[model samples]
Target chain A: MKFVGCIAILAALAGTALATEIPQADRRSGYSFMGPDSRAMQDDDTSNPGMLWVLDGETLWKRKAGTAGKACGDCHSDARVSMKGVAARYPTFDKALGKPVDLEGRINLCRSNHQQAPPLAYESRELLALTAYVAQQSRGMPIEVGNDPDLAPFVAKGHELFTRRQGQLNLACANCHDDNWDRKLAGAPITQGQPTGYPLYRLEWQSLGSLQRRLRACITGIRAQAYEYGSPELVELEAYLMSRARGMKLETPAVRP
Target chain B: MARPVLIALLATAAFAACGPAGAEGLLPYTVAGDAVPDSLTGTKGDATRGRALIVERSSTCILCHSGPFPEQAFQGDLAPNLSGSGSRWSEGQLRLRLVDASHFDPATIMPSYYRIDGLTRVGNAWRDKPILSAEQIEDIVAYLVTLRD
Candidate 1:
C-alpha cells in the first residue's frame, strides 16, 4: 500500500512538471509577430477590418431568428456582461455529444437546440459575425481552458496530432511552431501556433477566417489531406492549442499580416 | 466463374491503359543505397541556373535552408546550413536528398522535388507534376555540390 501511494505521488509530480510545453516566460502571442502596421491596426478598432464582422454580429444578436423566434440576445442579454471570459474557456466538453465542441460548435448547438434554427454553415458570414462578436467580448482576458479533468483525454489526443508528422512533407505542427518559431521562413516569421486570436482578419486572405481554416491551410501546405471542418480532430487540436495558450491574453478579432 | 474471370481481366486492362499512377511525367532513375548514381536528365546541370533557383522564391530552397548566398537578406533556419553540404555528402547523396530528403529523416519538412507518388492532398496546380522538373533537380544537385565549404 505504501509503494502504491509513492507511485501515485510520483505520477502527480510528473504531470505537474510536464504541464507546460513552452515555458510561461517564453510564451509570445502571435500579435508580437506582426509588424507595426498590423499591430497598429489591431490596437485601433476603427482601422481594423475585422471590426466589420463584429459589428454585423452585434446586429444579428438582437435580430430574432428560427422557429423559436428568439435572438441570442434574448437569453444571453448583453454579450459584454454575459459573455465576458466565455471565449477563453471554449472547446469545452459537451455532455450530450460525449465529446467537446468549439465556440462555433457551441453557437450552432444553441441555435439548433433553443432557437430551433438550422445550424449555420461552417465559415458562413453569419457564423463568423456571431463568433467574432462573442469572442470580442473576451478580449484582453487570459485564456483558461486547461484545467478541466474531463478534457484530459481529448487534450492528449490533440497533443498527439500536434507532435505527429503527417502529409507528403511529413512535418508535424511542432516542427515549425515549437522547434523553429521566431525564425524566418523565406522572410516570413513562424510564430508559435497560439490560439489567442481567432475569427481574426488576415491580409493574405483579404478577409476574416477561423482557426480551423488556418489549420486546414497548414495541413494542405504540408501536402496532407486536411481534416474536415468541425471534425473531432480539429476540435481536439483546438482544445490542445487553447490549453497551450492558457494564461495568454485573448486577442479576438485581431488583425494579422 | 468464367464470366467473373473475364470481367476481372477487363478491369485490369482498363487500369493498365491509364499508365502507372503518378509515374506518367516522372523520369526513370535508379536508386542504389542512399544515392541516385546517374543524372536524372542524362546530362550535367548548369550550376549558374542552379544558383539562381536557390535564391529565387519560386524554388523554395532557401525557405528552409540558409546557405552562402550573400545577396539574399532573409534565409531560413529550419534545416542545416547549405555551406558545407558538398563536403558532408557525395554528389549522388545530394541528388537523393533533393529527390527526397525523407530518405534520411522521415520527418523532414523538405518536399521531394523529383518524386510524384506517395503524396496526398497536393494542391490542384501541383498535381501529377513534381515540385521540380528533372532538369531543375539536376541543376539544384549541381549547385549543391559546389558549396564545398
Candidate 2:
C-alpha cells in the first residue's frame, strides 16, 4: 500500500514537475524532518495523541443533532466506506457559495443546510474532531485537489499571500518555507510548509490543530496581524497549500514536534 | 467586506500609534544616509552588557543568527553568521541595521528593534513599543562592533 502511494505521488510529481520551483526529485514530505520518537508516535495509533480526537469524532459522527435530529451517519452511513478519498479532494469549489470550502466548512454547511444545526465554531474541539475523523479515512492516499478552473483565482490569491512580504519583520511565507526550509532555526528544522498532516498533534500546541491555526501562528510569528479563523483569506491559503501538496500522501492525525 | 476589515485594521493601528512609546518613550536618533551615526542613548553602551543580551535566548538574537559565542550550543542558521560584522561594516551602519534592517533590504526578516510606527497587528504587550529600547539597541550595536572576526 505504501509502495503504491509512493508511485502515485511520483506520477503526480512528474506531471507537474515543470510548474513547481521545487523539482520532483527534491520534493519531500514534512515527515522527513521528524526525529525517531515523533515517527514512532505517528506510526503507532495507540500512542498518537491525535487519535484521541479521531476517537471523539467517531462518537460525534453517530450522535444525532439539530432541528432535524439527524446524525451525519444517517446520510453518509459508515464514514470509512463513504468518506474514503473524500478528504484528498477537499477545499473544493462550492457551487452554491461560488467559493472553495474546506473539510470543516463542508461539515458545517452540511449541518446548517441539511441537518438544520448551527455551524460549528472554528477551532473548537468538536469541529477539530470531526475534521480529523474525516481526514483520517484518506490517510496514505495521495492528495488530489484538482485544478478546478473555478479555484484558480483563489489559488492565485493564496500564492500571492504566500509570497508577499508583510508584518513588522517584513518576511513572507516563501522566505522561510521556500528559500530556507532545509536550515535550522534555534534547533528546530524548518519543513517545506506542506499541508499533509493536519489536524495533527503538535508538541508545542499540546493539542490537535487545523492548518488555519498553524497559518495564523506563522503570520503572528512574523509579527503580522493574522486573518480571522474561517476567513476567506485563510481558506484561499489552505486551498493553495493543499494544491501545492497535491501529490503527497495524507497523514491525517499524524504527530509532530 | 475587505473595506470594513481594512478600516478596523487602520483604526487598530491608529490606536496603537497613540499608545505609550517604548520603555521610556522612543528616543529619537539621526539617520545619516545608510547609518545612524549617533547612539540611540546619548551615553556610550557597555559591550559586556551587549554581549549578554545577544547570548541570551529571550533577546532572540541567536534565534536566527549563529554568532561567536562558543558557550551557546544551539544557534540558528536562518541568517548570516555574526562572527565578522565589525570587519564588514562601520559602528554607525551596525546601529542602523539593528534599528531597522528593512532600511537596507525592504523584505528582510530581521525585526526593527527600535521602530514603532507602520507596524500591523502588534500584540497588546508589544504595541507602541519597539522590540528593543534605545539602550538595548545601543548595547547590541556596541557588542556587534566588537565582533572583528
Candidate 3:
C-alpha cells in the first residue's frame, strides 16, 4: 500500500511537470492570420479579389443556362433576400441522399435537378464564383447548422473525425487548431481554423477555393493521401468545422494569408 | 456459427479505417540520456546541414516548432522551443524525440521521422519510406544540441 501510494504521488507530479494546458476562452478567427494589408483587402469592396469572383457570380445568377433555359435568378430572385442565412447552414444532412451536403453540393444539385444545366466541376472557377456569391449573402449572420435531428449522426461523425488522430504525423485537427491556436507558425498566426470565410480568397493559392480545398491542403501537409473532392470524410469534417463556428458571424469572401 | 463475431470484427475494421492508428506495441528503449543506436553514417554530424534542413519548408520542422532561429523569419509555436533544448534533455532523449516523439507522448504533435509503421494514408510515392534519413536525424540532433544559454 505504501509503494502504491508513492507511485501515485509520482504520477501526479509527472502530470504537473508537463506544461500543456487546455486554454479557456480560446476564441479566434482565421482573420487573426491577416495583417493590416490583408484585412484591408478583405474589407474593401473594390480591392478584394473575392469581390471579382462575386461579381462574376452575380452575372451567372442572372444569365440563363441549361436545356430548360432557366437562370438561378429565375427561381430564387434577389439572392440578397433569398440567400440570407442560407450559406451559414451548409454541410447539412441531405435526407434525400442520406448524406451531408455542402453549399457546393447543393449548388451542383440545383444545376442538375432544377436548373437542367450541367453540374460545374468541383473547384472550378464557375463553381467558386457561385459559391462565393451565395455565401456573401449570409455575411454577418452567425452559422446555425447542425440543429436538425437528421444531421446529428453526421455531426457526431464530424466530431469524431475532428478529434481523431490521422496521417503519418498522427495528428487530429484538434491538436493544432484547438490545442495550439492563437500561436504563430512560420510567421502566420494559427487561428482556430474556422471555415467561416470559405470560398474566401487565399493568398497562398492566389485564387478562390472551397473549404474542401483548404482541408485537402492540411491533409497533404500531414503527408496523408488526400481524398478527392466531395469525399464522405471531407464532408463529415466540413460538418464539424461548420459546427465549431456555430454562432460566429459568417465572413464569406474573407481574405487570408 | 460465429455470425456475431464476424459482425464485431467488421465493425472494428470499419472504425479503425476512420482514424489514423499508429503502430501497435511501443518500440523499447532506455531513458535517462542513454546512447541511441547510430543509424546515420557513423561519421561526425554537421550542424550547418542540420540547421539548413530545419528551416526549409520541405523539412517542415518549422511548421510547428520554434527553434533558436530568429534569422529564418518565421517559426511555429505549437511545439516546445528548440532553443536551449540541449540543456533540457540528453542527446539520446533528443534523438528519441526526433525518431518518434510519440514513444514519449502518444498524443505529441511531433511526427516520427524514422517510423513507417502504424501511419495511415501515406502517399504511394513515399509509402514504406521514412520522412528523414538517419543522417538527417543525426544532423538535426547535432544542431539542436548546440542550443544553449
Scored by TM against the true chain B, the candidates give 0.83, 0.81, 0.73
Q: What is candidate 3's lDDT per residue for B1-149, written digit by digit as tens?
A: 58657645654554365312453332222333334544234445788999998998878799878877878877887778788988887777778788777666555677888777877778665677677776788898888888886
Put down candidate 3 lDDT per residue, A1-257, tens digits, no spaces: 99999778876754443333334255557886678899999988899999989999999999898888999999999998999999999988888999989999999999999879899998899999999999999999989986878888888887777766667666767777777777776767777878889898999889999999999998776777887899898898898788877888888899998
For residues B46-85, write the lDDT of model 1, one tens digit per residue.
9899999988977778888999988999898877899988
On lDDT, the stronger of 2 and 3 is 2
Per candidate, native contacts kept equal: 0.53, 0.49, 0.66
Local lDDT at A8 for model 2: 84
Mind giving the per-residue lDDT tens digits that candidate 2 earns over A128-167?
9999999999999999885799988888888878876666
> What are the per-residue Cα lDDT tens digits for candidate 2 across B1-149?
78657655654564365523442356656578898886665567889999999988767888899988888888999889999999998999999899888777554668888777767566555677777777888888888899996
RMSD in order of candidates: 9.1, 11.5, 9.6
Compare candidates 1 and 2 on TM-score and give the better one. Answer: 2
Runs of candidate 1 exceeding 4 Å displacement: A1-20, B1-35, B55-58, B68-74, B83-89, B102-108, B111-133
Candidate 1 displacement at residue B75 in angstroms: 3.3
Sort by DockQ, best first: 3, 1, 2
- Per-model C-alpha lDDT, please? 0.85, 0.84, 0.79
Point out the higher-scoring one by lDDT: 1 or 2.
1
Better of 1 and 3 by DockQ: 3
What order do candidates take by lDDT, descending? Answer: 1, 2, 3
